[model samples]
Target chain A: MLKILVIGATSLIAQETIRHFAADGAEFFLVGLSADKLKMIQDDLLVRGAKQVSTYELDLTRLDKHQELVDTAMETLGVIDAVLVAHGTLTDQKAAEQNVDITLRELNINFLSAVSLLTILANIFEEQKRGVIAVISSVAGDRGRGSNYVYGTAMGAKSIFLQGLRNRLAKSNVTVLTVKPGFVDTPMTAHLKKNPLYSDPRRVGKAIYDAMKSERDILYVPFFWMFIMMIIRNIPERIFKKLSL
Target chain B: MKRYESWTRQPKVNHQTIVPLHWRDELPDLSQFDKLVLPFGLGRSYGDSCLNEHGILLDVTGLNQFIAFDEETGILRCEGGVSIEEILKMIVPRGWFVPVTAGTKYVSVGGAIANDVHGKNHHTAGTFGCHIPQFELWRSDRGRVICSPTENKELYEATIGGLGLTGVILWADIQLKRIPTPFIDMECIKFRTIDEFFDLSEDSHERYHYTVSWVDCLAQEPQLGRGLFTRGNFYDPPLGAKKEPRALPMIPMPIDLPSYAVNPLTVKLFNELYYNKQLRKKIGGVIHYNPFFYPLDAINDWYKVYGKAGFLQYQFVIPYKETREPIKEIFRRIAKSGQGSPLVVFKTFGDIKSPGMLSFPRPGVTLALDFAFRGEKTLKLLDELDRIVFENGGALYPAKDARMSGASFRASYPRWEEFADYMDPKFSSSFWRRVTSS
Candidate 1:
């Protein structure tokens, strides 16, 4: 059976990820920050008939413990077939702009943590020469905008890092999936205004799962975001810098 | 290099972002690239399905040329890059038209086939892919080869709605459907509810040669899905005015609409007036084929209405059996969400199996809605809609979907593995990169 580890299992996308893999009879190790959240997910996976469900209380920002967590999860679940790095913090741009600590935390959780986990998982997957790593990035990474450039910068870094990782891992048969979602409905975005371009976590999860299975390089969850971002990214610098996009 | 005197849009793809790559038009002797994106006439495709990103995007319009035509047989052979506008310019004067035309004639033969684009006639004639007898595809791995229904069938199916992932289409021999004339006899019927719209749409199939409906998204409850149902057929002379002269006059949106111009208040007002104006019990009329087929082509850069932040067009198809319910639900959700951006449309699809295993279509009803770039809440609502679509066993259209999850994609297109197996190893794109890399 496939062994999968869904980091940030408490997130909406991660919840869908757990359901998808668990439903397929794959063994899953759902890791997150809150024990209660992880247990709830474990119960859902069990009810969905997962091969085996395990929960790990994880704080991805504790970069030092990332490898140990992977090692422990591997020890508990046997060889890892896929690793989904879905954990991220949607740091408030206004708050971060005012507080250095908030900005640092956003970077650490959104970019640095994924980088650390990917580095470790890349090595492990390289050793195995066969495993998939799915990273949930946002279309916000396509370009920096006044609205959410801080978060965009973090995702952009993650996207670029994953691109490099993908290039390096090409020969190793290790698939690195970068999911650039346009907009997804999640608790993180509940307070925001309704978006016509928004996508659901399940849709994001499906796109990620499909990308992993197909070994796609980068996927615009929902797909239209590719054009939307392409247009946004290509806006001449003279014009783009002036807009509030 | 061949150049026509027509006042053509220098770079025809819909994405104003594309800077045409100049190359020698001497064909049969092209560059050796790992992969090339064929950007046909109007890059109308909502996604990069037509873009190669960092790879070479072969601007096929340069190869635009009419190779052969059999007026009697209605069989036409043309260069892959020939645009429908180019065809209409020549053939419409000679009394002929495309068997099927998407919302715009700006698309090239290659883009049309690559997208397997359907139009009002989809319920009758099927997609452009279905009419193609065969096409020449240049694959990085396999080299140049001819593919058709009976020859290299897999490659043929893969190329259509394959999102150009299969290879570059060189030229094609397509069987065109002949019409009595270049003009159309039209009729407009307005409906109040989703149920009435579907009923009329289904009933119109037996009585009309062409049919399409424009739904007003801002309308709520009783007025939901209210739209002008237009059905028409080709007619001669006095029956219909000679098709509108191709006035090469460019009508660009004078200025970018104010950022907040398309919010709920304005859209509601616009929808109310638009609905009332089309509230006529019956409006029988005769119209030119150009206005009937490519209405939006008259207004260039129309997307600028959403201001610099281009809008997103979400088109989804639900099976015929579950059409009314989901559409009602989808409209209700949109109305309740207060993310009002209009130009919502609903059309009944006829019987035609999707060309590609993962192509988006079934015996069903399809709805398309346009939304301006709003922040997070818009995404959340779309996510909720995605769940509704999933639960109904409907699939989102890949050509227009940009926010679908990998899991949802897998579930929607179960035969994705089959399409994946044919993906050119060297064929990598930013879109592909985004999906594959994490």
Candidate 2:
């Protein structure tokens, strides 16, 4: 049975991905912000056929506890075959633009906290010589936009960090996958107006699971997001900077 | 905000507020919203029952999460928003299946319970609510109430087929049936008359676990009720056989066809071809469960075939009398109206009683047909059919009805007033309002 550690265990996408592995009797060590939600996910995973599931409650923004989180997971699961870092907040661009505290908090949760965990997991996986490290980034990371530059910047930074990690861990056989999902109909986007563009979380979850199992380095969930992002990236900077996106 | 449509895509109504909830523990404070709120599932109720018009829709699709499942007991506890498709994906590989399923796998468990959905095997398993041992109903006033047959019995029975007027079902514990494999041993036979169909139905009930028929609504005289009868049992694949994949992606219907794409002439031709597709007198084989139970689910948004104007499914059940004469009269009226529906499902509901107080199925003959909305013409035809059904002591399925009159509803479901007593004051739907006060 494969042992997996999921950092955002209660996240809709993370829970969905974990379910795919659960049917195979994979063991899980879950880390999340809410104890109640994590407990629910643990029970969910157990019923779905997980061999074992353990949860740890923590405010992930406290970078000081990153190492302890990994240590606990290593102790509980013994050998982690995969780690999915999927917890993050949807930054309110309006609030972020007006308040430095809001902007900083978004950065702390979306970028720095993830980097803290990845730094520890990367070293452990490099030393162990095998494992999958999957992170959920956003298509907004492809290019910063006026609508959400704060969130875009954080996701861009996380994507770049994962890219470097993938380069460093390649020779060690540690697969680092950066999943860039487009507009997903998750709780994070629940307040936004939904359209045909928003993909279902289940679809995104299945894509993550498939990409992790196949050991792919980068994935544009729904695949169409790849072309959509490419178009945005190629837009001339002069024209891109003028039009509100 | 997204404008939501029910499966039938008819009677489009704008819900003032749409709240898509993700976590059960984080249920919003109901008192904050002034308007009545109806929990919306997969929105597959075919009509206005799933719509709230100008009120609030607490979209529950985001609450799709499983709580527990026991391999030995075949009992699954999951959030109400979990779809039958998701359940099948999880349990089929584990050698278990839903105790009862509708014609479509897209429906959420809560919607299924609220409507008390029935399936091909309803003769044996009864309605979906029959197998629901218990569920958690979160009322705006009462907070969370655990409803079961033995506890809160009145509310439990009322919530089933209560048309989303009771409260939002938080989660449910369903009893699943064990299956050796996700395949069915199916037998198909052809029938030429209503009496032959009735005879075949009577015989199949004793021999088959699942049974249904396709009737040619356009047929006349000698071939008045010509159609195909199909029956099946869960196939126990021989040991060492290759196991089928857990789930197959449904082929999507990306766009709606033109409004005139499904006219009577086209329907007649389609029905003719479908009836003659099986050349042999009788055919037997092993078929996958997906097509056996949910043929339309094979194509995502199959209803789009009826085009942008949308369609309405008219399904009703009349008690089986000593004669098969009433069905012929109903079929003749349909044929004469020239509003032929290509997909007409004819089946017999057995003696199995549903726990739902307003459940549509009984020991009777049930007929379901789809008609593309043609404004007044279509409504007039259906109104005529309603009078005939009411006269025959039949009732319309509220889940599939968009315009059933209040008198007809009251006449059919005599317990409406009793059921109304259990409904949450803050919970209501367009269907409820239309049927209760029209």
Candidate 3:
């Protein structure tokens, strides 16, 4: 059986991803911040005919707990066949700028924490030479405007980091997949807009699962996003900065 | 368990199934079940019509088998998943073609009926559902059922454009129209104003079987509705010249380009060039059916060009009497928005009855346009257009729509409840969940 570790397991996307792989009889060790949420997800997975299900309550921002979380997961499950890093916080840019502490917290939660966890997982996969890493980034990183540039900067950095990881792990037979979703209708952006090409979490989960199975290097969730963002990304900076977009 | 959040992208409210069972070819033996949703072909539908989110989504592509063909009568029977493109490849060379075709031929027969798709020939031949004589539907409550206009009339009507809420379609028998030749005698006409364009469309409708116009959305004021109208009908091939058969080929876009590629300026420039390039007021040419019907098919994975943020396709139809007013208002609003994206199309639909109770068409004009998601502004503009459609007594095509309100839906499709009554509760989807719950 293919063993999988899903970080931020309670997320809409993570839950769906877990359920997708679980239905395929893949073993899973789910990690999330809420014990209640993890239990709910675990129960749902078991009912769906998952091979095995385990859960760990994790505060991803706590870098000190990163190694322990991975250790616990590996001990509970067998060797990890895949690692899905689906947890990230979307801090309001204005709020982050207002407070220095908030800025650091946002940076750590969105980028540094993910880097710390993925680093350990990547190293383990590199040694095993038989695993896949899937990261969920955002299209907001393509080009940051005044509205959400801080969050976009964090995502941009994460994307670059994942790219380098993919290149470094190439020879080791470990595949790294980057997923850039535009606007997703999750609790993260529920307040923003309703169905604004906001991909359903289930769709994102399936796309990621399919990408993992196909070993695709990168996938834009809701395929159309790839083109929509292409049109946006091609605009010249001089012209782009002027628009209220 | 909801596997991939992405799959839940386009579900109905309250009926959204968190987990979707992904099956490739073989359909699960549904003999034991009481209700199931059949989602075959492409998921281009606007509503939860085909999706039974909570139950099973029987993929019928694997059952695709071309059964019979009448060389003389031009009648054919094929499995549900057999797309129009597949049919064109087999029949076009023999001078036979489908009675009607939608903008995209990638849709399966099952989808074609589920939506009661109408094409450029709708004015002349009616919708695709009208040409279909018989079909086999597998229902959970009732086993294998054969239906047609004369046989199981209610079930047949319910199944046609019924959004597959009735059952899984196994195969269908349809009447195909025979043409003198595979080539079309086409003409292109340019109109500087919407009024002039409608006049040309009215004139062409009397003379030609196929009529459509591509509007330049970027045009302002005096040129707001400037467009190129193309009309055609099959014609006999010249004597002694062998007909050059054109095959429909699949095109796929391999890579995702960066966002920010298509903006107002770029699209404006492109539309200007495209509109201007067709300098000839009228020209006769023999073009492939694929390009004529499914232009987007020429470029595979064309959606990827939209970048990481997917675009939304908004298509609505107004009754013939109120067509000009609503269309003019919609165009005026679009031009004023100044956020240009290519692909604004307009066409006139002929007398056609909706197969399903809530099916979205009437004898009138239809307009389809694509817009990038721009948060509140886009929604506001769409809301304005929705009001226009509602006021004009026109409904939005649910297949190509993603963001329509319940109130608007109620206004657009007055017979929604009649169709809703037949919805198998177990058969729920994200699209249905959103609409119902909200």
**Best TM-score goes to which candidate?**
2
Q: On residues A41-118, what C-alpha lDDT tens digit does candidate 2 reach at each position?
A: 888788778899999999999999998989999999888999999989999999999999999999999999999899
Question: Deviation in angstroms for A161 in model 1?
Answer: 61
Candidate 3 recovers a fraction of native contacts equal to 0.00
Q: Candidate 3, residue A196: CA error in Å?
A: 28
Prediction 3 global C-alpha lDDT:
0.73
What does the lDDT read for residue B173 in candidate 2?
A: 96
lDDT of 2 by residue, B93-124 (tens): 88899998888898999999999999888888
lDDT of 1 at A205: 76
lDDT of 1 by residue, B349-417 (tens): 888775665566667888877787686877788898889888898888766765677777778878777
Clashes of 1: 53
Lowest lDDT sum, 10 consecutive residues, model 1 chain B, at B1-10
Q: Over 4 Å off in model 1, which ranges?
A: A1-245, B1-41, B236-260, B433-438
Q: Which ten residues in a row have the lowest lDDT in candidate 3 chain A?
A: A190-199
- Each candidate's TM vs. the true structure? 0.57, 0.95, 0.59
Which is the leading candidate under lDDT?
A: 2
**Worst 10 contiguous positions by lDDT, candidate 3 chain B:** B248-257
Tell me the deviation in Å of residue B318 in model 2. 0.8
lDDT value, residue B299 of candidate 2:
67
lDDT of 1 at A175: 88
Interface RMSD, one decimal, each candidate: 25.5, 2.4, 16.1
**DockQ sort, best first:** 2, 3, 1
